[model samples]
Target: FKDATVWTSEEEGILVHTDVLIKNGKIAKIGKNLWAAGATIVNATGKHLTAGIIDEHTHIAALSINESGQNSSAEVKMEDVVDPEHIGIYRNLAGGVTSAQLLHGSANPIGGQSAILKLKWGANADELIYKNSPKFIKFALGENVKQSNWNSYSRFPQTRMGVEQTFINYFQRAKEYDLKKKNGEEYRHDEELETLAEIINGERFISCHSYVQSEINMLMKVAEKFDFKINTFTHILEGYKVADKMAAHGVGASTFSDWWAYKYEVNDAIPYNAAIMQSQGITVAINSDDAEMSRRLNQEAAKTVKYGGMTELEAWKMVTINPAKLLHIDERVGSIKEGKDADLVLWSANPLSVYAKAEKTLIDGAVYFDLEKDKQQREAIKKEKALLINLMLQEKDKGSPTQEPKKKDQEQLHCDSL
Candidate 1:
């Protein structure tokens, strides 16, 4: 891209009238009046360019959300159920999101593992995953795991204290399992215990779904007991209350801009949670747990500027670099640095503003969503629909048998699905 106002999401902040060169799917150089012969030129004189948005928490590409057969779904992997043809992937691309962390639902005390994905629309399941991405598992606390919303009392750990004990029991079993394996003792292979053993051995990280401070502290202490760190806390509504504790624990916070008071546990959530967490030396990222909201995440970052007095550049990082850091993919696609993956978005205006539109969204230097192409596709669809309806009318005129149209079933599996 040429001659654009670059929001580097780095120490230099925004640069004006700069030229960025992307070569071989990596950012080659960034400077003024730069030119490469035979390279495509994008005249972005009055536009803005920034790193592609990364959603820290999402469930868009998953075919299923939960495995309720057991309270500890540690053996289930999110990668095994990826839905490549989901429309949410293309929609997120149009909204300038290039990457996301597809996590498991918050139903089990120990839920399924996570799938780190690059939003490569039209790709196959395995092709969409971020290669060699660090392992991540979902852990939950509070009401959902305790079955507070459900009338059934059959699920174990129906209380908050039971949630803690559940972890202790599993980790204890995993610890013994690890010891047996190290001692070269013969034993039956347990997938669930193997996954938990990875966490104990520091080979995998945890992203907990939590609300309120007590459970937050409880999980952190339990992690300490197991000698591993809780990597992140997603949907952390009341995180402001334990900002210092989280920072001391070296845990990152991925929170909503203003989502709160929707549930009993989130009654104390404040819009300033992101800013407060950042203020206390905690890495903070604003995440979208909802599919519809995931597309407009840039504006969600803008909300932090209003709610907590964060600067424009700082707020932008909340969606870009901070989330990348949380997902451990910052070294590849977070910023506009040289040699990094050329995952970028060209905007019609300042990206933080609601008025801005993603004119182009690119991953690995390939344009996946183009506004002009989208407009053309819309017109083409209208023409095709008209043609199809006309053919159907002709069939009716010929006295041909016709069947009523049946709507395709939409699949959206939540925690309660199982």
Candidate 2:
């Protein structure tokens, strides 16, 4: 990409009329008049270039997001159910999102393990995962896990206090299990306890689904008791209330840009949650729990500017470097550093502006989405739909039997919906 206004997302701010050279799927250099032999140069004059957006929370590629039948489901994994053909992946790429943390639903207090994936549209499920990414698990607190809105009451941990005990009890069991294994005592292997043992051993991190301040504080305390730190708190709408505690605990905050009042637990949610947490020395990242919201995360990051007086660089970092750091993939894909992966977006305008559009999105230095190509694909889809409809009409005129199309309902899965 050459002659573009670049938002490098590094310590130094934006660069004007800069050239970027990508080689072997990594950014090789960033300077004026950068040249490479036998390389195809992209003319990005009058456009904007920035690191591709990273969504800290999402459930786009999964066939099933939850195993709510159990109180703890650490055995299940989001990677085992990834669907590469899901159109949401392509849509996200078009919106400049290159990577996302595909998390499990917040049905159980201890949810399943998560999968961090790159938005490589045509790749198979195995190819989509970010290779060698750190392990992460989804934990939940407050109403959703306790079944506050559900009609059924058979699940365990129906109260906040019960939730806290659940973590304590499980961690204790996991510790005992680890001790037995370490001492070479013969014991039955448990997948759930084994995953928890990894956390106790600092081999895994937790990205918890949370909202209320009290529950957030409780989880942190529980983690402290177990000698582990909660990696991040997702959907932390009431985070501002306990910003100091969370900061002191060394936990990151991955929250919605501005979400509130959708449920009783979130009544106290405020738009300034991210900025407030940032002010308290906590690393904050804006995340999208919804599929539609995941596509427009750049616009979501821009909201912090209006709601919390964050500068453009800080707001943009929430969706880029901040999320990368939380997910432990910052070294590879977060910023436009010389040795980083070439996951980037060429925008029609400033990414923070509402008028901006992702003209081209690149993952591994390959164009995954281009505005002109998208237009052609849309036109092709329309033509194909019309042709199919015409063929159906001909079949009807010939007195052929026809059946009504089946409508399969896509389940609306979110952090609270479970």
Q: What are the lDDT scores of the predictions, listed in order?
A: 0.93, 0.93
Q: What is the C-alpha lDDT profile of model 2 across 155-246, one tens digit per residue?
A: 78888999999999999999999999999999998999999999999999999999888899899999999899999999999999999999
Q: Pairs clashing in candidate 2? A: none
Per-model TM-score, in order, reads 0.98, 0.97
Best by TM-score: 1
Q: Which residue pairs does candidate 1 place in steric collision?
A: none
Query: Which digits, one per residue and each the tens of the lDDT, describe model 1 over residues 3-105?
Result: 8999999998999999999999999999999989889999999999999999998989889998876789999999999999999999999999999999999
Error of 1 at 367 (Å): 0.8
Q: Against the true structure, candidate 1 has what lDDT?
A: 0.93
What candidate 1 gets wrong by more than 4 Å, as runs, is: 413-417
- Measured by C-alpha RMSD in angstroms, how accurate is candidate 2? 1.3
